[model samples]
Target: MAHYERDLTGNVDDLVAHLDRAIPQGSISAKYEAGSDHRVGDARMLVRAYERYSALGGNRVSLCISVLAVGEEMSLSMVSAGGSEAVFFKVNTFGEEAFLERAIQALESYPG
Candidate 1:
């Protein structure tokens, strides 16, 4: 598994839209699987799950993203798992990292 987290300053809706577009850009098999959006008090929360076929590992990898926002401040968390190449053990993590990179790349230019 691979994980990433970041603290950002931006509108939750904007960031979510940006991710929704960029996360699935490179591969045809990449897709958003599920999501939840909630607002409690002043905070808005979004949780999303995505999956993609990993050729390097010959399996499907899953990526999950969570965002919590209060006004203009936001916190983002991402995790990637599965797609290990080993049959008996979780050895290869390249697929997870690679799939996670799509989100990283998406955030590169975000002014958050």
Candidate 2:
């Protein structure tokens, strides 16, 4: 698990830009649900919108994001792709919107 905490400042776009800057290529796989149930592009978009909303509030933010690689026979195989990678963002006390945005950005941008 990797952790990041900061006095939040910036919009979703800013966070996305930050993510683009922070994460390297070939790190993150496609975004999926918590249980790895679905492939929803709109879910990713919602996270982006939340990040933008949090940026306007200047809230204290903290996050724990992790990357995992799982094989085909795993229990959480719904989203797994026969040794695919997954990223998880866990937030605490931060602006919900901001935290979610950062999480999504981190998920999308992280280098596996």
Candidate 3:
């Protein structure tokens, strides 16, 4: 598995929409599996799950993105998993890491 986290300032809705567009555009096999947005008092949260074909692993891998915002501050977390093919211990993590690179590129390219 691979993980990434960041804290920044932006409109939650806009950030979510940006990621919604950016993540899936990285590769032809990338896709948005599901997503959710929720609000509580002055805070908001968004979670999105995506899948992409991992050529190295010969399988599909998952990427999960979670965002939380309150006022003008936002926190983002992303995790990539499911590419390992070991029967027990983990192996072949390159596919997972490559999948995560998509999210990193999208976040770095965010206009905010």
Candidate 4:
């Protein structure tokens, strides 16, 4: 799990658009949901991947990312399958900071 607080503001649509650019197209499938909670904007994403495991003959990957925004503050969390689960196995192969950096970049570049 990861957490971030930022002094930025934007609509959920704009935020989701920025996130869309951050995610890679190699994802086999992706789902996104955006809404507001107590005046705070929120977005959730689920992504499934099989491309990385095609060569290794390994299990696929399932990733979930959630973002919450209120005023000039934002919090983000990302988790991947890593334990005994239903559809995919979890693997903590990368640092959350990497994803956070990409999100920050996206937020900065979004004109809205």
The model with the greatest lDDT is: 3
lDDT of 2 by residue, 1-112 (tens): 2233332322334444444444322123223222222224422221211112223333322332322212211110001111112235343323443344445555445333
lDDT tens per residue, model 4, 1-112: 3334444455654665566655543333322333233432344332222112222223433345455655444555545432222345434434333433444565567676
User: Which numbered prediction scores highest in TM-score against the true structure?
Assistant: 3
lDDT of 1 by residue, 29-83 (tens): 9998999999889888899999999988889999999999999898999999997
| C-alpha lDDT score of every prediction, in listed order | 0.89, 0.30, 0.91, 0.43
Give stretches of model 4 more than 4 Å off. Answer: 1-11, 26-57, 82-112
Q: List the candidate numbers ranked by TM-score, top first.
A: 3, 1, 4, 2
Window of ten residues with lowest summed lDDT in model 2:
73-82
| Segments of candidate 3 deviating more than 4 angstroms | none
The better-scoring model by TM-score among 1 and 3 is 3
Candidate 2: regions farther than 4 A off: 1-58, 71-94, 109-112
Model 1, position 30, has a per-residue lDDT of 94
**lDDT, model 3, position 36:** 92
Q: Which residue pairs of candidate 1 clash?
A: none
Local distance difference test, candidate 4? 0.43
